[model samples]
Target: MHDRTPHAAAAARYPHQSHASGPLVDVSSPEGGPGQHGNTYVQGFGNLADPLAIDGFLRIQEGRVNQFLQVSDRRAEAQRSALQQAADRLSNIANNIGAILKLEHEAIKKQLQEANAKVDEAVKARDELRRLADGVNWTGSAKVSDQEIRSKWKQLEYNIRSLASVLAKCQTKVPSDKLTRTRLDEVSTAWRKLLVVDDYKNFLIGAYI
Candidate 1:
């Protein structure tokens, strides 16, 4: 009869096998297989099951994220400062423009006032000249006969010659005396009246001549 125990059965299945004659395979080394290369199984992540390695990677990513956030904040602050500066410049420009406009307005207002004053003065002078002209015309149009005008003209000529002689004598003799001065003023006034009458009679004699 054959032995049927478990160890006798394994010996009967591989009668030529022995522990020392088998090839030794290293499972931990990637070069142990024909298709294996460096880090082929892990895909260069380096031990995905390790907590310390994952934590280090996470900490590096967090550092990068924080650095990016800080850079973004600084850029935003700089932009806000630049915008504020631009706004301040615009405000100053607007104020300067407003001041310029105000000055121009004042200058125009003063010019208008001066123009109005000049216009008023010219109108008053023109009116005064017109009144004087009207008075001369009215005086020339008085209703006097030609005979009367000729007689008045002769009398005025005589008075003018007599007054001129008196004024020449007084100027030579009593030029500074108060009584002589008064008499000279009266004589000058009478001479002016006689001259006015002479001019009127001349206008009347134009038709006769």
Candidate 2:
């Protein structure tokens, strides 16, 4: 029979077994290097270098775009300012022209009134002279000779011709065209010459007497 007891003659030949001990070899390294420590450091490379650099480039591009926008905005503002200034200037010029036109109209009205007054005064004088002459009674002179009467008639005829010349000068014709500044000066000169009536003056003398 086989005995399984712990203390036997075969067990006495081998002592009690224990754990083995030795310096562990680093098999991964060709050259024997330092042993691995408990603490480990790992290094890894991801995509491109600095992500912040790419962000910076984008910001720069954005800045350029913003500068262009600012320039365009300023240009538009300048154009608007110029147009507004021009409009204001034109409006001022229009106002000034209106004022000048108003003054011209008033002046023309006053001139026409003066001209009418002169004409009325002349008519009144003529009428008064005619009435006075009709009221007076004429008597024939006994001493007046035929030659003297003929001489007096000749003088009266000469005076009549002179007065007719004056009346012709005073009368004016309607202007047919729009008068410019230069032409207005000419018209004024012509009007001034029309005020003197030599023919009318001669007629008044004879008719009144």
Q: lDDT of each model, Cα atoms only?
A: 0.57, 0.55
Off by over 4 Å in 2: 1-61, 135-209
Q: C-alpha displacement of 49 in model 2, angstroms?
A: 13
* Model 1, span 19-91: residue lDDT tens: 3434544344554544345446665566777788889999999999999999999999999999999999999
- lDDT at 187, model 2: 38
How many pairs collide in each candidate, listed in order? Answer: 0, 4
Over 1-209, each residue of candidate 2 has an lDDT whose tens digit, in order, gives: 65566545445555463223334444333345433331122111222345776788889999999999999999999999999999999999999999999998887666566545544555555554454445435565244455755655555455445444343444344345655434544535443333244534334332322
Q: State, as a TM-score between 0 and 1, how close model 2 is to the true structure.
A: 0.40
lDDT of residue 88 for candidate 2? 100
